[model samples]
Target chain A: EAGVAQSPRYKIIEKRQSVAFWCNPISGHATLYWYQQILGQGPKLLIQFQNNGVVDDSQLPKDRFSAERLKGVDSTLKIQPAKLEDSAVYLCASSPRGGGGNEQFFGPGTRLTVL
Target chain B: DQQVKQNSPSLSVQEGRISILNCDYTNSMFDYFLWYKKYPAEGPTFLISISSIKDKNEDGRFTVFLNKSAKHLSLHIVPSQPGDSAVYFCAARGFSGNTGKLIFGQGTTLQVKP
Candidate 1:
């Protein structure tokens, strides 16, 4: 079975520029998630989508970050006016369901470097 | 607040020895715990998981032990191989008022020498 797929793999952008990352979840997966992993830190949940509907995005910075899963199969995360602090790896993950106790499958991630 | 924490940043062990990674969580509502292995430039892969009701779960040479009373958990690898060298992350599920989100630790980088 194929795992979650992400685009770019690596990206570089200047501060104040806009950047977008794409994610395609595993086949038949019902839940998708976006996370940010800074250097030396664990992945931090940015947003979650359950079949095109947002399940949770409380930790996301509404002022600069936004994410959407329009058709439920693919999703995109965008950051506008990127700051130096936005330099981190963006990971996408999927699961069979959106409930607890299910293991999430992760993608290779997009490493974003904001200069 | 950081709910989950891995105090050790790195560990080194010889091949065929035992590798123990520890994790502590402050939240009592976590219903599930998981360990993920990650290599440089690669995403984390699910290694093993254990539910709160079960104290121990083993898969191959990897064993996870949970202590609810102390809110601590550990991942043990026996006869560790060189391929086992990677960053191990401890994650917990079931945050109150959250929807199936996982809280992860800083991770511990393990090195198994040949």
Candidate 2:
């Protein structure tokens, strides 16, 4: 079985520029998530989608960050006018369903560098 | 407020010894806990998990112990090998309706020397 897939394994952009990251979760997965992992820190959830419907986005920066899962299969996370602090690895993960103890499968995150 | 924390940033252990990585969480509503291992430039992979109802869960050589009263959890790797060197993260899930989003702690880096 194929694991989660993400594009643009690495990205470099200047501050104040716009950037976007994409993610394609495993087949038949019902839950998708986007997380931001700064250096030396664990991942923080930015947004979560349950079959195309957003379930949680409390930690997301509404002013600059936005995410969408049109068909619930693939997702896109965007940051406008990126800041230096926005430089981090954007990881995408998915699970079979929303429940306790369900293991999440992660993708090779996109390393974003904002200069 | 940081809900989950791993006080130790790094630890070194000799091969064939046991490596214990500790983590503490502040939220009492957290009902499930998990451990994830990550390598440089790669996403975290699930290692083990334990429910709040249970104090211990073991899988192969990996074991996780949870102390709900203290809000502390730990991961233990026996007979540590060089391959076990990586960053381990602790995650917790709160009982917030249908949202199962996990809150993670700062990772602990383990270095096992032969």
- Residues forming the 10-long window of minimal summed lDDT in candidate 2 chain A: A96-105
Highest DockQ: give the candidate number. Answer: 2
Candidate 2 lDDT score relative to the true structure: 0.92
Relative to the true structure, candidate 1 reaches a TM of 0.98
Q: Per-residue lDDT tens digits of candidate 2, residues B1-114?
A: 899999999999999999999999999988899999999878899999998999999999999999989999999999899999999999998755777778899999999999
User: Clashes in each model (backbone N, CA, C under 3 Å)?
Assistant: 0, 0
**Chain A superposition TM-score per model:** 0.97, 0.97
Model 2 docking tier (incorrect/acceptable/medium/high): medium
State the C-alpha lDDT per candidate.
Answer: 0.93, 0.92
Q: How well is each residue in A33-99 modelled by candidate 2, as lDDT tens digits?
A: 9999999889999988899998888999999999999877999999998999999999999999875
Which residue pairs show backbone clashes in model 2?
none
Tell me the docking grade of candidate 1. Answer: medium
